[model samples]
Target: MSTRSEALLARPAAQLEVRQRITVLLTPPGLWLLLFFVIPLGVMALFSFRAASFGAQRQVFTLEHYQRFLADTSAQRLLWRSLLIALETSLICVVLAFPLAYFLSFRAGPSRLMLLTILVIPSWTSFLLRILAWKVLLGSSGIFNSLLLSLGWIEEAAPILLFSRGAVIITLVYIWVPFVALPIFAGLERINRHLLEAAEDLGSRPWQIFLEVILPLSLPGVLAGFLSVFIPTVGEYVTPLLVGGVDGIMYGNLVQDQFARALNWPLGSVMSLVMMLVVLVLTFGLGRGVKVTDLAGV
Candidate 1:
């Protein structure tokens, strides 16, 4: 073969080899996701349309679960309540986390790693254990009530502390702040210090600089934090189950009841699918909205 023709043939062979190597590298994780995530999701999707049977097994397919969920007033209320609580939790986490994130990113000096370690320490413990600790702290005879009694701040140990919506919200906020703040801190750290200096050089006040430079740049972190907190909070069962009392019960609790107590797999699968869809929709919608908002403001 001519030298040029031989080089052309070699190039295609090299490209094929590279493509094969890339596919081999990606195949394992792709198969893992297919086995663990995609297959289960497919099964759940198929089962969502199946009928729930009691004493006798039903081999028929139906939309009874989805229809019932849509038509039932209590179920609808629970869905809305879950959405509201998750939104509120995300908002509060952002508000509380921003300052801490900013400080950690800009002002922590040599202790930044140490402070971050402290923030993450709680997460190393079991989630249920943390919730149980909150239960103890907020119980009528718990430390909070005891302190109030000793200080004469309350006439008696308040009965509304544990098993209340407030307790649920408080516990959620405590658990999720680290998830939100760490992302925000990472986003803040990526911001160029020169930009802030240039904003100040232009006679921008601190607030102006933050609004113009810092906030806009840190948005990726903020959005990440919101998603991390909001998505899981919407499906939160444990915190609400333990501390929410009757009033604080959320959509997830209902789903859990269907699977565990009611033995209604089809119905539970429907609810789980619905929750997953909502999370997916919110993720795309909020991400687009954030991009638009940033562009419009800028």
Candidate 2:
């Protein structure tokens, strides 16, 4: 036993050396996140418990902010609305992105890079500009109304499209389309053609192939895209402010107002924490629900 133990102990130190090297490499990013992400979150959490006076000053630590949200029915309703909108946006993006991604991966062939260039080109312009452009295209006196009027299809301009819930969805969809497409496209592109071909050779119909192969493989990308859109959209403030009105304003706008205008940082910080926790729970739950790893590359 001793001889065997010594033999094992006497093995090359290459594994330990490699591990040490890896540790050295990972330390920088670890420290960077510890300083930036963890530290800032800690600070925000500390502030979240503090009491806000009538004039924006925070006093000693208190549970007022946290309790206030729990007790406020309107705030709870607004939170639900924010979550629903985010989910809606994510669902829409995922539904639209899947086919486009499949096309880019399977049909576009070597031209994908070029297609991707055009697809993502809309991002070069400012997001606000994009929303404004949608306003011009959809508003009462916008181009669509003008076109319909020119054709004598309408007696008057369409209802003012600005400052509506639909408009907000349209603008946000435009802003985030690229985000959904890129990940799904990359996922589909990583699929092995042979697997698909083999499935087809076995007399699987197109729909069957897609159901049994393509979709199952693309689950990871779908989840990733969902996360990308849903998380941010849950906290969406700008789209609601620019394109939506009182009815369209989300929980994020309220949170922003709490901090910026109302000068209620304690509530804002608490709200932010609650929103983050909600997002984390939903992300993990969705990942588990979808079995995200199998389609990780897809």
Most lDDT-accurate candidate: 1
What is the per-residue lDDT of model 2 for residues 68-125, given as tens digits with 9 covering 90 to 100?
Answer: 9899889788889989888888888888888888888899889988988898898999
In candidate 2, what residue range of length 10 has the lowest lDDT sum?
Answer: 289-298
**Model 1 CA deviation exceeding 4 Å by range:** 1-18, 53-57, 289-298
Cα deviation at 149, candidate 2, in Å, is: 4.2
Residue lDDT tens for model 1, 1-298? 5776556557878668767878999999999999999999998887787776453445678988889878778876888899999999899999999999899989998899799889889999999999999999999889999999999999999979988778888999999998888888888887899999999999999999999999999987898888878988999999999999997888999999988999888888988988888888988888763543332212
Q: Which residue segments of model 2 deviate by more than 4 Å? A: 1-28, 53-59, 148-160, 289-298
Best by TM-score: 1
Clashes of 2: 1
